[model samples]
Target: MVTRIEWLDAGLELLATEGAPAITIERLTDQLGVTKGSYYHHFGSAGGFKAALMEYFEAQFTTRLIDTIDAENAKPRAKLEHLLRLVLADPDNAALEIAVRAWALQDPDVRATQERVDAARTAYLKELCRGVGADVDPDRYAQLLYLILIGAEQVLPPIGRAELREIYNLTLRLID
Candidate 1:
């Protein structure tokens, strides 16, 4: 039997594969091979389902990226580099980002959440820049790094893990 978490996961998969327009309660229920009653048991309505999805995405980001970066043993530089590598390594993240961006265009709540995520990521990067004693403003460097990382997701070819590590190392040297 599928759990509520499973339904949310399926929703994300559907969004990633078919785009936001394709994710309706009916479609999701059909895809999950469950009835509308089952979906409603988990989420009260279509809006409720979307709200849950946004929350789910936020939690996933928190667990997968935010918490990882905040580990007590990880240095600031290591955190920043790990963030870059994680973003680059995830095959689905680029698409997920694109989908969320599209959703944000229509939903104020989503736009706010997106901004919050960007802010959190930027704050972390700024701390890393400060730790490294970079001459430029940490916030500015953080925004620059954020743009570069997003650009890499959109424009760069698939990079091997070792190659990405090398690139991150070289980029850090430039910043410092």
Candidate 2:
């Protein structure tokens, strides 16, 4: 039997590869080699699946990363580095982000989800900046960092992971 996580994972994969428009019940069922009943059993409808998928994205991408970094009990700068490493480790992450950002532009619900994710990530960055005792304003610095990442993901062809990682390193160095 296909589980809820399997459905959500397939939905997320479809979202990342083909944008939100491709995430229909038919596509998910076909992609997962399951029946419509399976999709309905887990999500009730396409809208329900999208909603759950966004929640899953937010939790997996934001809260889980923060929790994982926090669990390290490292110093602030170390945690910051750890965060960067963890983010860069997943190449699919950038693709998913780009797809999601595009989806946000055309969907109100998606935009709201994107906004919350941005706010949460920026808030964490601000906390880390303060903990790192940077001389710059934490809010501005955090926002700047967050903006760079968002901008990077939206640019034509998008920034490659290695280049983006270097860009992050340079930005982080500015406060170091």
Candidate 3:
């Protein structure tokens, strides 16, 4: 039997490749090599499945962004750079984020969830900036950095390790 987390991961994979509109109970079950009944056993409906996706995203961002940044070992600058590196390294995440932004245009719930996650990410970035003694408004810097990071995902071609490190370094300087 597929666990809820497994189902959600499959859903996100489908969303990343085929886009949100392609996600349906039948498609999910087919992708999972299960029956519609199995799908329903885990998620009562398409909305439930989508909600699970959103929850997964929230948990992922919280773990990677909030919890990772709050680690006791890293300094403020290191934490901020680590956050950017994490974002740059995850192509799956970048694709899912692009998919989610598109889905948010039509789905209010998705939009709300995306906004909530964005707010949390921004807040964390802001705190990092303050910790580094940037002498700028944290929210403003956060917003600017967030936009740049998202835009970088689009404009810059997919990068390798060295290129990603360069971009992270540039981001740190930009915000600093």
Candidate 4:
């Protein structure tokens, strides 16, 4: 039997590949090679499924990732570097991330979730800045970092690894 997580994973894949409008019960069921009964069993309706998807996205991308970074024993600089590298290397979530951003432009629910995510992400970056003993205002640095990450994701023709590294290195130097 397909679990709720499986259903959500399929939803995420569909969202990444086909955008927000493709997140219908019928389409997801077809994508998973399942029936509508299974979809309703877990999510009850299309709205339910979409709500779950947003929750899952926030938990996985923002909450869990921040928790992992905070829990790490590495030095602040190292922690930030690791996160930068991870973000730069990530390809699977790029499309989904952009799709969600687009969804936020029209949907208040999505916009609220995106706001929460942005706040959490920026706050974490500020924590890292403080941890590294940076004299600059942590909030400002956090904003800049968050902007770079989000902007890099949105830019047409994704930024190359070399450019990513250069940006990361420059940010690290400024922080240090």
Candidate 5:
């Protein structure tokens, strides 16, 4: 039986490859090697699936990551470095982020979810800045960090992971 989490993961994969328009039941069932019956068994309806998918996206990509980082007992600088490494580790994750942001442009639900994610991410960055004892305003530093990331993801071809990692490392040097 395909669990809800598996369905959500398949939805995200389809989303990354084809954006939101390709997330129909037929497509998802095809991708998951399952029947429409399985989808309905897990999600009840399309709207239900969409709602759960957004929540799952936020939880999987944002909140849960933050929680995992917080579980570490490392110093602020170490935590900051760790966060950068984890977020930039996977190229596919960047593709998903870009796809979701693009989806947000045309869908109100996606827009709301994206807004919430951005706000949460920025807030966490600010908190990390404060912890790092940033010389500049925490808000400014946080927004700058996030802006750099969002901009990096949106650029033509996007910044390669190595270059983006180095850019973040340079920013990290400024933290101390």
Candidate 6:
């Protein structure tokens, strides 16, 4: 049987595969091998489904990371390293982020949600910087770090796992 989580998961896969423009009740129903009734029962409308997808994205990537970092018993540097490793390990997650960013350029609601996610991510990174006794301006450092991470996904060749782990370690050292 279809569930809310299943719908969101399917939406994410559809978003990654076809971009936001492909998100429709009919399309989702086809993707899930279900009917319109299931979609309507879960989401009320296509707009509601999109809204839910945005919320799910924010919760999965931003809120969960922040919670993990805040609750980590490791040292600040270790926590930062762990965060970097977790993010860099997931290439598919990076692709979804890029897809959402592309969609945001056209949709106001999506742009708003993307803005919130960026702000939250930067704030979390800044907090991590402070925790690590960074002498640099935490806010600025956070922006630079986040920009590097996002920019790498956009412009650089895909990094190997070892290379990514090295970079993560080096970044933590630089911040510390």
lDDT of 6 by residue, 10-124 (tens): 9998898889888888888888999889888988987899899999999998999879777878877787777887787677887788899999999999999999999999888
TM-score of 5: 0.96
In candidate 5, where is summed lDDT lowest over 10 consecutive residues?
75-84
Q: List the candidate numbers ranked by TM-score, top first.
A: 5, 2, 4, 6, 3, 1
Summarize candidate 2's per-residue lDDT along 1-176 as a digit string, tens digits.
89999998987899889988898888888888888998888888878988999999999999999999889878988998888889889878888998888999999998999999998999998888888887888789888877887788878888888999899988888787
Q: 20-107 in candidate 4: lDDT tens per residue?
A: 8888888877778888999889988888888899999999888877777778899987888877777666677778899899999988
As for candidate 4, its clashing pairs are none
Give the total clashing residue pairs for model 1. 0
The Cα RMSD of model 1 versus the native structure comes to 2.5
| lDDT score for residue 58 of model 5 | 99
Task: Give residue 6's error in model 5 in angstroms.
Answer: 1.3
Model 1 over residues 50-152: C-alpha lDDT tens digits? 8899889877864458787776587677777777777667667767877887888898988888887777777777877788666777778778777765665
Which candidate wins on TM-score? 5
Q: Score residue 94 of candidate 4 by CA lDDT.
A: 77
Query: Could you tell me the TM-score of candidate 6?
Result: 0.92
- Clash pairs, model 3 backbone: none
State which candidate has the highest lDDT: 5
Candidate 6 colliding pairs = none
Cα misplacement distance, residue 120 of candidate 6 (Å): 0.6
Model 4 score (lDDT): 0.83
Q: What lDDT does each candidate get? A: 0.77, 0.88, 0.78, 0.83, 0.89, 0.83
